[model samples]
Target: MDSSENYRVVCERVAAAARHAGHEVTLLAVGKTQPASALRQLAALGQRAFGENYVQEALAKQRELAGLGLEWHMIGPLQSNKAREVAARFHWLQSLDRTKLVAALDRHRPADAVPLQVLIQVNIDDEASKSGCRPADIGALAEAVRAAPRLTLRGLMTIPAPHPDPRRREAAFARMRVLFDDLRRAHAGVDTLSMGMSDDFEAAIAHGATLVRLGSALFGPRR
Candidate 1:
């Protein structure tokens, strides 16, 4: 399918999934390596939120597409050194996992801007290579974010180990749902549970994901 056709199909599938789950699910088009023109096309089609994994690339896109009034999400693991740029520029940060990052982001966030929205990325499967914090440490991280004057705690995000079996994937999503609920109960503004991706977003929604990040599924394979 071409980009327009792909967008239509993905929107249809997302609507169907949301209906099945009996909740509204927001879509964050993962525009990581795609050019600004592609994003402009989608923006014309009514997609305003875009997710980017790399800071520099996202920043460039933001500059080029500044007139479009797009909402940017930092969906990759963020290094402490890059916090200021992300804290000032992106609309959301979906990979926050440590207290030190919270402090850095808060301090660097522009005084004129509103509190930066953030989610705690949980390494649910405990993969050593991943950037998220362990499941057990969510409470502390949540507290730290809450204490930061420039950040707003917006619940959890997880990239579950890609188990080929649907049941195993569902199990991981279920665990994330429980964790999301626990976090919501403890924090007042914890609303977004950003789990799911191209292959597993439906399962993520069924198990309680308010937002899904899609890259190849929406834009075809990266160049």
Candidate 2:
């Protein structure tokens, strides 16, 4: 299938999954390594929100397609040195896992621009190599984000330990849902739970993912 066909099929599947999960969900097209032309194709299909892992690459795309009015999201591990760039460039940052980065964003976000929407990435399974904070650190980080003047703490995001069993995947997503609910209780209007990706999005949706970040499932394998 071509990019458009892939996107159409992915959307249909996502709707089915969301219906099963009994909730509305946002589709964040993960366009990390894909080119701007690929993004333009998805944009033609009305896929407005795109997620990118790297700041410089996303910046280039943002410039190339400035006329399309796309909403860009930073969905990768962020460094303190790049916090300012991330704050200024993306509409949403889905990998906020620390307090120092939170402070840096708050200090550097453009005063004229809208507050940068943010998500607290939780390393749900506590993988040593993952970029998210541990479940124990979420509340503190969420609280800090809530207090940051230029950052809006939207909700929680997670990259669970990959598993072959659908039940195991659903279990991880279920844990994220519980944490999401707890976050919403403490912060008003905390709506986005960005969990899941190309491989396990359906399972993530089945467990109540408000946002599923997909790449190959939507754009096909990168060339």
TM-score of each: 0.98, 0.97
Local accuracy of candidate 2 as per-residue lDDT tens digits, 14-123: 99999888899999998878999999999999999999998999999999999998999999999899998998888999999988888899988999999999999999
Estimate the TM-score for candidate 1.
0.98
| Residue 95, model 2: Cα distance from true site in angstroms | 0.3
- Which pairs of residues clash in candidate 1, taking residues 3 or more apart in a chain or in different chains? none
Count of backbone clashes for each model? 0, 0
Model 1 regions more than 4 Å off: none
Candidate 2: regions farther than 4 A off: none
lDDT of 1 by residue, 52-116 (tens): 99999999999999988889999998998899999999989999988888888998899998899
Q: How accurate is candidate 2 locally (lDDT)?
A: 0.90
lDDT of 2 at 15: 91
- For candidate 2, the C-alpha RMSD (Å) to the true structure equals 1.0
Query: Alpha-carbon error at 195 in model 1, in Å?
Result: 0.8
